[model samples]
Target: MLKTGSHIQINDTTLRDGEQAPGVVFTLAEKVAIARELAAAGVDEIEAGTPAMGDEEVEGIAAVVSQNFCTRVTAWCRLSETDVDAALRAGVKHVNISAPMSRLQMRVKLKAEPDEVAARVTRVIGYAREKGLEVALGGEDSSRADLRDIGLIAGAAAKLGVFRFRFADTLGLLDPFSTYEYIKRLRDETDLPIEFHGHNDLGLATANTLAAIRAGASAASVTVLGLGERAGNAPLEEVAVALPRTADARTGVDPTRLMELCDLVAKASRDSIPRAKPIVGADIFTHESGIHVAGLLHDVRTYQGLDPAMLGRRHKVVIGKHSGLAAVRSVCAAVGLDLDNSVAARVLARVKNIAKTTKTLVPDARVRSVARQELEGAETRDMAPARAELRLHP
Candidate 1:
């Protein structure tokens, strides 16, 4: 179990791995702006970009590095000196030197034995440290690698002054149970700070990431909106909010400003935010069901699992086919109209009919019109008895 008050660090890779999303490209200004926002949101680190992509990419990374953000800025590099040289040109003080750790990756991709991969790790990491750059080692596909080999590779890197070891779920294959066990086993092997970099192929990245933290990983890799190659990486917003709630861990990321940051990334990446996306979606805090609305009207806690107030937002009740009298009254009152129980019932009927016909929620004007008609009918019926009594008495 994760100890309370343990500080969990967020290493945001939106610019590096996130931009790897197909057809997604961020200009230099966009990169710098994102890094600035991440820093302001109290991200512990920013993975600026892969400088080995060439000079244009290097220049962009340099622009971000120039800001000298409060958060540490790092570049991603493969197990090659050329990659490290490119990062050096970009003016970053930190680098994550990655090497394939799995035997399959070693045989198919590198065409080398484990010893050769180990040799490359030592050389690249040593060069990075000699260049006066802080280093972290990424064990690519560590989830599939042999545990004994991971211990050997990571132990070597740790002895050579590497500060952290990143265990990446490169294929997004591991579930929460395996994730916990993976990190737990690795934790017993090395004292180096472990970071979990999870993918979302099975839509379990957030859960797996939290599990890693619970298993003693100190950091997590995240993107602004789970943006990455294939499905995506773990979403920053989900993990940030989930940490404090699930593990009693704090990331120092302001949950209230998370939506703003997500919007900025969405606009820059041209990736639309899903209406139902957790933590930063357009409709997560909206309610429409009659039962839920009634319960919320009586006590907000009844229907609320996570407080919207924490994100600088409030819960909203929208009228639809599932709406009830309580919801109709709540909507009417917002528009400066009071609906009695009978009138509210009538308006709710209209709301459901309109919603069914349109296949959407009813608007305020339509609901108000229904309530006006109901009130008018009530007044007409009330006057009929008085008028008849006056005529008979006269």
Candidate 2:
């Protein structure tokens, strides 16, 4: 939903660039399923795959095109006739044709002069337009490219009727503050629709993406669960959850299914989502601290920003050293622990010692086990030990 004047659209690349994550491959069936999910999640577009790859790649784009799930599917390609022919053969009507606008990509990769590549882009855009396919011009290494020359390349694409000009931090080296400044200047210079594509080598993709939107980016490229080559790209779920709540802009991502989508990316990608990942992590809503559990029992808002119920999650009170007496009582109430003052004291002492020794949060099952062992110790000894003991049962 557009609120007033928010500038944000999602061009998800989970199936395309995200699959480029080393050692991760998505089968045809897997790619189609993810494309459908991305469509269902309200993303504006999907960068399906590179058509120039092979028949398998072409078939994948066709599979997504066949579904036609209200998402525009585009292919990434060089600004060359061969790549354009492959894209057309794959039946994808939209393509992001690009070249090295930077001295790095142009000089090193293309090994062509600046003026030479710029004219080549214009010619290819005209060719794609003639083929009746919509186009987005990609400035491959704009982060390191001269800003004035970048604008000139973009203006050339604009002159050829390309509206979306994607500025890529191909090396994942740009910071959030610098990203905003450059993108802000870019928007002022051209009327083209700006899309920010960031990488996570510096672990700043999501942060920089947000800054880009705040500065006037039309869309931000993202992947599910932050899956991409090397350090991966900005996470689609994180960008969705953070932007609307944190920025003047908003995107159309389903907040409730954010975790479910994270799970989907993890399972399909065969990578485990971290337990502390924001918004959708396994432990994000699971409270193990005694103090936190106590506060949560009174009101979940005391411990969580968004309600667990909203994400179809239940709040769990686990026994840990950081937990207070109220949390202990709550977990016991949930699990029928029913401990008296003496038993509670023994359990609390055991929790403290365990956390201190392990240097980590104590788990609930361990607390319950310790309580049982303490009962056994008292029963066996007939009297409490003269000194304290924090012993493990197993």
Indicate which candidate wins on TM-score. 1
What clash count does candidate 2 reach? 6
Q: What is the lDDT of residue 384 in candidate 2?
A: 58
Q: Give the least accurate 10-residue stretch of model 2, judged by summed lDDT.
A: 1-10
Candidate 2 stretches greater than 4 Å from native = 1-7, 17-19, 335-342, 351-394
Q: Write the per-residue lDDT of candidate 1 for residues 1-394, one digit (tens) a residue.
A: 5678889999999999433689899989888888889999999999999999999999999999889888999999988999999999999999999999999998998898788788778888988898898999999999999978888888878878999999999999999999999999997878889999998999999999999999999999999999988989999999999998888899989988898899999999888899999999889999999999999999999999999999999998888888888888987788788888777877787778889999998877788888888888888888885434445553
Which residue pairs show collisions in model 2? Answer: 289-323, 290-322, 290-323, 290-324, 291-323, 291-324
RMSD of 2: 6.4
lDDT computed for candidate 2: 0.81
Q: Pairing residues by index, what is the TM-score of model 2?
A: 0.88
> Tens digits of per-residue lDDT for model 2 on 190-237?
788889899999999999998888777879999888888899889898
Report, for every candidate in turn, its global Cα lDDT versus the true structure: 0.90, 0.81
Identify the runs in model 1 with alpha carbons over 4 angstroms from their true place. 17-19, 385-394
Worst 10 residues of 1 by lDDT: 385-394
